[model samples]
Target: RPAKKELIRSGIVRTAGRILSSAASTPAAAEKTMALLEKLSTCTEGRAAIGEDGECVREMVRRLMKCSGAATAHGISALWSVCCLARDAGAQAAAEEANGLTKVLLVMQSDCSEYTRRMCVELVKILRVKSTTSNLSPYHSRTTHITPY
Candidate 1:
């Protein structure tokens, strides 16, 4: 955990945002970056640092299903840290604006650990409520019937 603090002290979270946004970032590189991000997100300062950068949040959202299982797990965990754990509404909005909810749903349907799937579900709840379209949480009464507007 000390290493996470050291990395945060070195401003690696900001650098990480740039790396994730770079086109040169490969899947492996993204995975490693997400891993580091998840580690840093364990603390309050780290979550604030990450949540401050909309691009970082956006990139994490973009990485949802764009890499390996490790990468996906790291990405979701980091997002959960900033969005749910920290309860940063701005980060939640940034995520939704980046189409994070859709990617998270896709990830949940894929092969992933139950922990990650649960995190994705929580992220979905936050992102949906924070969406620009509505500020209320989604409720489904198990009705599968679709109604045309």
Candidate 2:
């Protein structure tokens, strides 16, 4: 029997949560989580359901980065993957720069997890390079660039 439309709609959040939990245990699942987060970040309607300012997305990384031992290592690596996407999008103005990256890095740098610290350093390095080129080109300089966001 086909599930009721309402039941299917109600199941979406649970399904996403399951995906996130599984991400912690498997590399393939973690990649899927990153992809799903990226899609959710782009969907205005979906984003609203999660929270204003994509807080849910941020929390996913936060949860992973805060885990202990081996789990923390994988979580931090997963977070680095997510942030790389955000950083790239931000450089092109395709994503909002509301200090999400900055805040996470601050926490990661002080994180008990060595992997988190390393990922934080890597993110900073990438951001430095991206920032250096962020304002280049005639359109950007002229303030007439129609940013994707």
Candidate 3:
């Protein structure tokens, strides 16, 4: 069981890294990458695989800033899955350090697809909850102040 899980994780992370590295040059490729991300979001091991790769998390966060439509939605969904399933402090810290929460807020306010908007909102809520409950704040503070426009 453990070996199979490791194999699956390794393959998914490698594929995600390849797609993310090359998908920036083409919209169709980006869309396909997002589709793969969304599919990966459906499973716990997949989410852990993505979270374990710092580069992958960073790339998805970057996509949140640059990509749109389905790609954007999938990126947000993937991050949400990581936040919920991985439950890893490093993953949450990476997202927070990358200003992912702020980007999600901006995306929520933009004229994105309904699915995108929904995922952004959900991601924000998840981050906020994690921050408050886990004391993940830099100051060990208890409150998370996210102002939405």
Q: Summarize candidate 1's per-residue lDDT along 1-149 as a digit string, tens digits.
A: 67777777888988998889899999999999999899889898899988888888998888778889999999999999999999997888889889887888888899999999999888887787667554334563446487898
- Model 3 lDDT per residue over 17-134, tens place: 6677674457667667777876776777777777777777766776675765677777877787787556656667677666777778878887787866776766776666545333
Question: Which one wins on lDDT?
Answer: 1
Please give each candidate's TM-score: 0.86, 0.34, 0.70
Candidate 1 runs further than 4 Å off: 133-149
lDDT of 2 by residue, 45-82 (tens): 43343332243344455444334444445444444554
Off by over 4 Å in 3: 1-10, 22-24, 113-115, 126-149
Candidate scoring better on TM-score of 1 and 2 = 1
Error of 2 at 109 (Å): 3.9
The CA lDDT at 149 in model 3 is: 75
Worst 10 residues of 3 by lDDT: 132-141
Q: Rate the local accuracy (lDDT) of all candidates.
A: 0.87, 0.45, 0.69
lDDT value for candidate 2? 0.45
Number of the top-ranking candidate, with TM-score as the measure: 1
Question: TM-score ranking from best to worst?
Answer: 1, 3, 2
